[model samples]
Target: MPLARSLRLARLHPPQVLALGFIVIIAIGAFLLNLPIAFHGARDLPFLDALFMSTSATCVTGLSVISPGEDFTLFGQLVILTLVQLGGLGFMTMATLVALVAKRRITFKERLILQEAMNHGSVEGIVRLIRRVLLYSLVIEAVGALLLSVRFLLEMPADQAIYFGLFHSISIFNNAGFDLFGMFPGRPGSLIGYVDDPFVNVVTMVLIFLGGIGFIVIDDLLHFRERRKLTLHSKVVLSVSLFLIVFGGLVILVFEYTNPLTLQKLSFPEKMLSSLFQSVSMRSAGVTTLDVGGMRQATQFFSILMMFIGAAPGSSGGGIKVTTFAILVGAVIAMLRGKEDIVLFKRRLARDRVNKAITFTLFSFFFIILGAMILSVTESYDFLGILFEATSAYATAGLSTGLTPQLTGFGKALLMAMMFVGRLGPVTLAFALTPKHEKELVRYPEGKITIG
Candidate 1:
């Protein structure tokens, strides 16, 4: 096929366009990172390492084969930050924003791509929603940076503090989990030095929550003040998110309360704070105030579950999404109770939505397991560690248990693939790879199978 024909065919599917856009962005990012000016050390970065970092940053997965703060120069860090921002908003949204600024007319195909990217129900008000999202992100990130910079200025030089504040604010808001704390004196661990600092902890957690919650939810809430009503999706997202944060925090507190390597050394108040941060971070943000590698096995397992569930849909964070998980649980309960509908908030979920949720959850689990199995064979790590790393990458949660840096080349490649899939999602990847099927004129009989 000619290049023009191939491009036209690609434009036929929104998912394919989105996936290809990400691949192109990742490739460009990798090439930029491979440049000598991007690094501070004498040796140039290996191609695989650059590719892995590019994938992680562009996927918003913080898993790094090397310490970014110590290894990458200012230019490199800026490049990573750019990738994070682009990845967080998604390429389609960014492109749309550019088109809006350039006064270019957005085609119907572009609108479809934006709708799919934003997970919107209709093409109507999509451009408006994009504008809202962009404005909202900017305002939130600016405020977060200002607040954090104030606190950071007390400890470091003005310029350094400003940069640190901006970097972290963007990283947390994007749920990217990349950090520059490695360069701080006596504070090598990410956010560990701020464990006891209420200002830092609260601000970081707030940003994480705001970002992890979908843009649709934010828009709903913003409009709710006037409408006095919230959409079912927004209601479910907020309720489930609050429950997960509180419940996950309590679980972490109980599991690691006596673990000397984690929270035992901290005061009661500090422990509570650490627990809350850990719980929130595990869901989507990968920044940690404690040693993830030293946590108890139970705590690690709990974190793995949280990571696998991840943040809400249409958000920067990846995974099956909280709504999907909730729908699955609701569906199971409905089935057991012999109910015809999977209902929540006095509303019944559409059959197609439930099916999509089930499909997403199952596919997510399959990929995580497959990645873990691959790692187990290629590396000598324990099963739990492999599983933890795999789930982290597969969910784009980035909360690693120190297994990422030690992974062999094959293992790294496997994880890079996981991060890419996790970010794009299995469904989107499927849509990108498979051609659309035509509906059959003949109907087939359905066969019932016996099950428990």
Candidate 2:
């Protein structure tokens, strides 16, 4: 009873409650992984590295300094996967589901927390929604695993291929990209080392794409079948995502098709496929068919942009999100229209939603800037690479220009903070932390500022 009271008090102080949950989860993961049996290949690691690994896993970002295969045993890998799953589905979601499994009645407070955790509305049957979320996740993952497993069988023996398929499927769907085929069977530049293998790329891309589009959209499509007319959110996500993928592919194909370092050697069709795959892969899914390190500056910059937009909301992938960008665009259009409002699909826009879009944008940009600035002071890397790292961390996109492992202690910590903030989100953390404003009785006269 004392513990419960203490926890409720902690919840009232929101920042600590959120931070504490993250810390506890990381601590548990590190402790389990720091066990003597955790090492796979007789290489003992520093405790800090284990903690970092745990944070990365829980964040579902693939910016790891160590190879999972050589560094950790099966037990540790399983633990990491569990954390990834828990993190991908918000920790609160997992707790709520577990509570339901135990047949425990949810406190009203728990229901509210669950709603907040998932960015969901105050539905009457929120617990049932959580169950639906879990069941839908399992079904999607299972189908993906089955499809991926089929693609893997011809290349690898039955047992090895099945495990590979399962691991990649979960990782991809979670947008975690923690590949066991690192360096292709632990050799550098290889995951089974055949980067050009047709089957692998296709299956991986499909898994990554499935996981990148937010689950809310999926749920909406499934539940509200008659509303095939589409919400602004769904329309924006679909259209923007498609456009970015295609446009990014065209850019990559044009830029890299002549570069000796990347897709120049491939046949034209292969190059196109690779470009298309890479474009889709960039929107917060980290699977890559081509080596990131050797790309041209132009290609690299464009890749950063895609990563910045990321997958849509309520999906596994993270970024400012497509809908946010769309809303921002719509806000601009509204201003140009001089209609005094932003409307989409002939529907009125909520000011709070627009403000949230802008806040998320500003928050993400400023957060990355702060991170890059810190990395500049602490690390020896040049400007562009550091910015890429910072943006990747903030977006939780996990693409790198190869500086992740070389990061200084401070750089790693900064990236870890970025990942955590990226996952919990800036507005959400701010909302949770800030004291609620009481209604003001008075308003000051408006003052005009200079126009652009």
Candidate 3:
């Protein structure tokens, strides 16, 4: 009976198993982070705080109760960075890479998990894809670190600059948004001090933009000889991402142009740079060069919408995703025209795909609203602030409105759950919740209900 029960439990579908894998890794991380050495001055981190940090890092969500630079020791920072990298690359992807490095054969089940994790269409060439992902990620992070180190050298000694550069390079590329600026004087206002520095702004934006665009798209662009040869998914992702960034930047620029606390004092070029950075960071990068708390109300609400849309699929970022949003828009357009199919760039989307997109978007909206509502009761923040915090966590965007560190334990737990669901995805969580063996084998006459 015990063996039977164990087998039944082990029979969880790939999504459920993948979710569990992240949970296990987070547990280990929490344990390591709770150690005395993880903190400065020999103070122990509370278990709940440790779990919250572990979940945030593992989910690649940048929301945190404590400043990484001021609160954690070097060992703790390393642990957080390790979680960010693993979470961004995904647990299964890293596992497959390790197996490959060890010269161990990968089983079909493992391939299935990797396929699901990467959202790939097939298992074919998955190993090769994993290899390319690892190689490309390392090279990109290394180049970013080198460039950032040169910039950081202006502020600190060589050794400190190098360490800060590496930490930020990993954090930015993973869209994790953990920052070391807290160690500096004044408030721990994330890259706010670097808003006028072109090198820092440009380099960090580039890293965030590249990382927000899905790795699959990067691989496709790299390998394809012609633009026409790129996959439809890649084309849609690129087009939507570019449009959102430009549009979001323009909106931010217009709204905050004269806001005294944000962009009013900046030069025209610096204003544009800060606007662009804000737009890109909202794509789930979580790093902010401007005072998010001081921005105009319009900008804050617009940012909430952007955070809800998040980034492209198969990327380190989260949200409903660019592709999902694109599909929903296409579907709406098709419906307005009374077309039977949703078409884009001469390609038609399947009915089920459109339905899934709508479902995911609705589910995302529901959770964001639910979280904000719950937090409004548990915390004393305004609705706008609560909604912003909820959306940021749901999108894993991590741009808080100064309400993060002020949350009650219950509020923090709610946001932690939102981050987990956001990272795993509403659809994936739905799959995990459903019974794996359930199937609709019998059908009756089709029934239709008219509404709207």
The top-ranked prediction according to lDDT is 1
Tell me the lDDT of candidate 2.
0.77
RMSD to the native, candidate 3? 2.7
Per-residue lDDT value at 428 in model 3: 84
Best by TM-score: 1
Kindly provide the TM-score of model 2 when superposed on the true structure, using C-alpha atoms.
0.92
lDDT against true structure, model 3: 0.89
lDDT digits (tens) for residues 51-170 of candidate 2: 877888887787787777667777887888888888787776777766767787877766666666666656467777788789878987788788777877977788877787777778
The sequence of per-residue lDDT tens digits that candidate 3 reaches over residues 57-142 is: 99898898988888888999999999999999998778777677778887676777778888887999887888888988999999
- Stretches of candidate 2 exceeding 4 Å from the true structure: 1-6, 9-19, 41-43, 183-195, 224-228, 435-437
Better of 1 and 2 by TM-score: 1
TM-score of predicted model 1? 0.97
Model 3 Cα displacement at 78 (Å)? 0.6
Report the lDDT tens digits of candidate 1 across residue range 1-452.
12213545755588888788888889999999999999878899998999999999999999999888888999999999999999999887887777778788777777788898888899999989999999999999999999999999998999999999999999899999999877655665678878889999999999999999989999999999899999999998999999999999999999999999989999999999999999888988989999999999999999889998999998999888999988988988998999999999999989999989988989999889988988899999999999999999989998888899998999999999999999998988888888876889999899999997
